[model samples]
Target: MLIDTHIHSDTRGLEDLELMAMCLDGVITLAHDPFEMKNVKVWEAHVEKLLNGEIERAKKVGLNLFVCVGMHPRAIPPEVDEALNKIRDYINHDKVVGIGEIGLEKATKEEREVFIKQLLLAEESKLPAVVHTPRRNKEEITKIILDEISTLNLKNSNIVIEHCNKETVKWALDAGFYAGLTVQPGKLTPLEAVEIIKENKDFANKILLNSDCSSNPSDVLAVPGTVLKMKIEGIGKEIIDKVSQKNALELFNLKV
Candidate 1:
């Protein structure tokens, strides 16, 4: 019942060793990046290869998947229009769930512009957006997102603030938006995450636990570890299930 909200499979139109390793390691619900490339054709080709790779990975390991095709904040403005058009079709793909991993990064002026622009694109496309909030100044980030939600009339139900920590989890939950916890080993830390989940009993419906498993191996398998911690903290299976499965389905609009 684990649905990973964020994952990147590097399909370089060739045999990807990292992807091979992920398939072997039992990763379900991978979210591939469609906006990772600078060239539109190259990005399209990469997405196609990722789709093929998902099919192969499914047959081999039963890996469920979700993918997004919008530029990350760091890699935008090269061919934004072309990239958006290319990804538009895939948004409705039978396996595709939403239009993200698409939001602001605390990188630079250029990155912020790209991120905000993509956020507008997500609004235009009427798809759920996955946002990467700054870890340190998260309250400010939350305020920015809330303002955007108001300005765009974007439903709180249509957004997920990813990699939220104890500092910012309450704000996201209070906003009636889905809050994603990125349970990395030492980054967000196991003890702090469990405490947050345990303490937020009232806002259970607004919470989702995700690995945010990236190219890094240590980041993978983080959801299971979080679940174990929740169990140890005397949290019920019902709450755990909500964090694990129900919230994801509600946020992604998934039938599963």
Candidate 2:
């Protein structure tokens, strides 16, 4: 069974959903900054879609759908406080898993403030956090992210530094946090992901493989595909199982 820990279902069409349900046991769809940063209402509506609409859509296809709510750093709205206030009400909902897709994009002051606030919220709610590391200046921004997280009282295990590359993955693991490897066109390929797993000792315990499938060019079957690659490369089944499913299930406390 496979659980894609990060995806944007709203950006994907029905065909993608059907394909996902066919291969995945479950998925954790997260909230991201919309193209237009209108207001808190936008964030509220998006959350509602994830919790209710998207959940039902996935259910219809026999896939267990989970959600994580938070404003994406790139799209932090003008009404950040109100947006967070709205998110608070949904934190304890059955479908909600954690606070995420939140982290520094440009490393601006506003982004930092919002990122820290959501981290605190996750800590307070005792939920996991999925943090985004940008494509450009990833290493530098990730350093800042780790530094900021260090100041907080949040548990490292409850944090997932996502979109991690070879370098950032080391930092995340060194910090005692989960490293999220997003398999997509521009992200790590299956072979590269397999190599990364091989290079890191006991990586299965700390790595989470995901598709991060969105409107962007991405393979929704990235996780299972990577699993195949791992097997072909002679990676042990136990290690593959942990990175592909167990770690995510435990981190998010997912029943499935």
| Candidate 2 CA-lDDT value | 0.89
- What are the models' TM-scores? 0.80, 0.97
Q: Give the TM-score of candidate 1.
A: 0.80
On TM-score, the leading prediction is: 2
User: Which 10 consecutive positions of candidate 2 have the poorest summed lDDT?
Assistant: 33-42
Model 1 gets an lDDT of 0.65
Best by lDDT: 2
Which residue pairs of candidate 1 clash?
A: 29-64
Give the clashing pairs for model 2: none
Residue 241 displacement in candidate 1 (angstroms): 1.0
TM-score, model 2 to reference: 0.97
Per-residue error at 23 for model 2, in Å? 0.9
Question: How do the residues 213-237 of candidate 1 rate in per-residue lDDT, one tens digit apiece?
Answer: 5555445556767777888889999
